[model samples]
Target: MTVTSAPETYPETYSAGAYWGARKESPEDCARRTAGFLNLLAECDPFLSHWYTPARSRRDARKHPLMPPDVATLAELFRRGMNREPGGPAIEELGFRFSFDNGGATGDCATLRINGGMSSEAVPNHCVLNVPWRGPNADRLLTAAVLTKAVRAMVLSWEPDWALAGSSAYKMQYPEPDSAPFSLGWITYLSRRIGTVPPLPAPVRIEPVEDRGTLIILTPERFTVANPEHVALARRVRELLVQAGLMQ
Candidate 1:
């Protein structure tokens, strides 16, 4: 007889995302945006610098470098990523999607998934950045200031309707109701199209992201659900934001 134990699973990692509605664009257009985003992301942290193209296997994927983003290579990648009906033609109304990751240590690796160039209102376009949790640099890299900049970079590159950066665990536990237009995070960005950001409580600061949108920071440190005070503050701020017509 033999006994085996499952590998220990770590806590949910943090993520940064930008979401937006339909915007008709070409493969080239999406490539340009992706290139800009990768360049901007590299400046956010050393852990997010090196990136590789996707392949049949991680080992194969690592053979290709995606940094110094080439517009032609990215454009072809998006073209190949176009949404297609099962055994049918490409879905024109849908969009393209591609993923890449920094190839390295588990603790330092980061992933980027992008869906864009959609022309259908029903199909949302988004860019998501998955952060590492157990790596040596995770603690130092996961800060309010750093995540805030990461979120702002998303806004600048994607011009999304909204953007958020925070812990996946906290978001799941304190999931915003369906009535709320968007979820609250350690850092949230609301485009001007949504509405003006109202004055919020102390420790909660608001800043403009150029003329595009407003950036809301809940705390100056890492927000953890383990802290009751952190949870409480987030709820209060969310309430105010909803009342101000920012979330609705």
Candidate 2:
């Protein structure tokens, strides 16, 4: 019920027409891009998540029969193409149209609580992005927020059955206790686990258990690479949003 960090956007639901288009990529091309992303992620940091190579190998090598990676080939129908319809939901005050499909979330200063269908892996989905932001990055935040929706759609397009991809969540705590993390973050693919749910990546330690369940947390001060490639991924993600017309 209580949220850790972020602002306020009340729950408002509306139907949306698909805003995504389609793009076609050859299998070899998909592999090259997957491999490229793996390399880019490594460039963002050194110690790899043990899950990276295996996931890429299976998806890129054209192994996963069900997994047709729509990572970069995200057409208009590619990801969160839901709100582009003529009668799509719009933020009247701000004059920006948005749609809520997966589910809702509450944002606090440093933490987030993903609600309903968005937090269920069994539902066949992708990781919901819940980044915290402030005044200076308002535009960035708006675009990033929309970007989050599409990215999840993108992730699901690739590995819709990712073990914990759509199922779990991470929350950041402020006024962090001696045991709790001062902040939290995860790599893009880290949420796109290929097979069974794996253990938490390096730099991430289990904080004290909550009444609900044990949380996958990151205490950046101690864990150097809690999110080795988030910055890089964020930049690229923005690019994707712009190209997809979710921004501007």
Best by TM-score: 1
Per-residue lDDT, model 1, residue 82, is 97
| lDDT by residue for model 2 (98-126), tens | 11111112221111111112222222122
Whole-model lDDT per candidate: 0.87, 0.27
Model 1, CA-based lDDT? 0.87
Among all windows of 10 consecutive residues in model 1, the one with the lowest summed lDDT is: 101-110
Name model 1 segments beyond 4 Å from true: 1-10
Q: Model 1 over residues 1-248: C-alpha lDDT tens digits?
A: 89999998558689999999889888999999988988898898877778899877779987888988999999999999999999999997798989888875565678889999998977579999988786677886789878988998899889999999998889888887666667889999999999999999989989999999999999998888888898999989988887887766
The TM-scores, one per candidate, come to 0.93, 0.20
For residue 244, model 1's alpha carbon misses the true position, in angstroms, by 0.8
Candidate 1, position 118, lDDT: 94
> Which candidate has the highest lDDT of all?
1
